[model samples]
Target: MSVDRDTVLKIARLSRIKLEDERVEPLMGELNNILAWVEQLDGVDTTDVAPMTSAVETSLAWREDQVSDGECAEDVLKNAPVSEYGFFAVPKVIE
Candidate 1:
């Protein structure tokens, strides 16, 4: 993609970056060079390669699926400033 000065200015505006006028020409040249390099990568062969998450091979360690209360109610309610009926009490906010 040919990144012109006008296109660079639009890109800067959209990205919310306050770029100086002198920087636009250099930035446009750099962006065009990057696009050209990426275009060159499209010709490489990778038909047999599988997609991978990491360069090194590894497996995730998963624990058993268990369902239970995290802790007894007594332990959780002990730290409350004001607890009633095994629940935290707060000042009334509604009229």
Candidate 2:
């Protein structure tokens, strides 16, 4: 999984990054080192490890699902500059 100079240049081009020719060699080495570290992670044994969504173990509080008007339409309409028929009113833009 070592990164070559051409591969580095191709990646830079695809990403639309303006990488200089002189910087390509150094970037290639850095990318290769990162890939080597990731490859090392494959050797770890995880047969007993359970996949988890979060590191902390916790349960969400359950609530009954009920549908109702929030009853705050009047409160919200107060902020509008002009409201008509229980809704916000704006100048018609379409001709």
Candidate 3:
């Protein structure tokens, strides 16, 4: 697949990029080159290859599923400018 002039402009608008008229042609060529390289990758044989999530094989460590407060509420409240009833206190913003 290749990108045309209109596609480049549409991409710029979708991305909120302020692309100049002079830059559209160059950007179109760059995008087309990228798509062409990706298309070339589709020609490779991956039938025997196994899908992998990471370059280096590793397993996550098992852990017990438990929930508990971090037990640092007092420590955390010390940093607050104003705290009350075991919680941070802020000025009321609405009536």
Candidate 4:
């Protein structure tokens, strides 16, 4: 799959990037090279290979879910610039 100048320009426009007319040719060539490499990878056999997230298999260590000490409403509202009814207060938005 070869990328032409028009395709490059269209891609640049879609990506919201402004590319100069002279830069289009080089970008097209680079994109085409990448596509050719992907095409080459299509010839490889991977029927026996298993999909993996990482090269080594490992399990994530996890801690037991247990609740401990928690802050009271007064403690939480102590640092607020404006608080009422044990909650942070902000300016009213609607009339």
Candidate 5:
């Protein structure tokens, strides 16, 4: 794959960046070099390689699923400026 000057200009326009006429050639050269480097990866043989989700091999340590409240309602309500019943009270927002 190769990037031409026109392609570079199109990319700049799509990204909402202003590319000066003199800078287009330099950007085009850079894009072409990046594309060539990426193309080189296609030559690597991966037929026998197994797919992997992470570079480091390790099993996740998971805990048993459970549901429980903090059981400290009185302790938490003490910090509220104005608590009503068992909940925090705030200014009425609607008419």
Candidate 6:
């Protein structure tokens, strides 16, 4: 399939692209080449190919989901500019 100057202009307008008048012909040729390659791909047969979700075949490595001992609240809050009641305090944004 060949792309014309008018088709290139229409595509540029649809894509919200600003194209110079001189650049239109070359852009149309490139677009036509891309379309022709796609047309060539359409002739290939994929009757026995299985659909793939991922390129690599592997299982997710997981760890035990259990709560463990954590750092002391005072130790964490020690670096805060402002802290109160085991929490960091900041300026209120809304009334």
Tens digits of per-residue lDDT, candidate 4, 23-81, equal 98889889998899889877889899877888777988887898666867788888999
Give the 10-residue window scoring lowest on summed lDDT in candidate 3: 60-69
User: Among these predicted structures, which one has the highest TM-score?
Assistant: 3
Q: What is each predicted model's overall lDDT from 0 to 1?
A: 0.89, 0.89, 0.90, 0.87, 0.89, 0.89
lDDT of 1 by residue, 1-95 (tens): 58888899999999999998889988988999999988987798879987778877888889788975677889999999999999999999898
User: What C-alpha root-mean-square deviation, in Å, does candidate 4 show against the real structure?
Assistant: 9.2
lDDT for model 2: 0.89
User: Model 5, which residues run further than 4 Å from truth?
Assistant: 46-95
Clash totals in order:
0, 0, 0, 0, 0, 0
For all predicted structures, in order, the TM-scores are 0.47, 0.47, 0.50, 0.47, 0.46, 0.46
Task: Mark the 10 consecutive residues where model 1 has the least summed lDDT.
Answer: 63-72
User: Residue 76, candidate 4: how far off, in angstroms?
Assistant: 23
Candidate 4 residues lying further than 4 Å off, grouped into runs, are 13-16, 61-95
Q: List the residue pairs that clash in candidate 3.
A: none
Which runs of model 3 end up more than 4 angstroms from their true locations? 48-50, 60-95
Candidate 4 contains a number of clashing pairs equal to 0
How do the residues 1-95 of candidate 2 rate in per-residue lDDT, one tens digit apiece?
77898899899999999997899999988999889988987898989988788878888888779865687889999989999999999999898
Clashes of 2: 0
In candidate 3, how many Å is residue 82 off?
25
Model 5 pairs whose backbones collide: none
Clashing pairs in 4: none
Q: Which residue segments of model 2 deviate by more than 4 Å?
A: 47-95
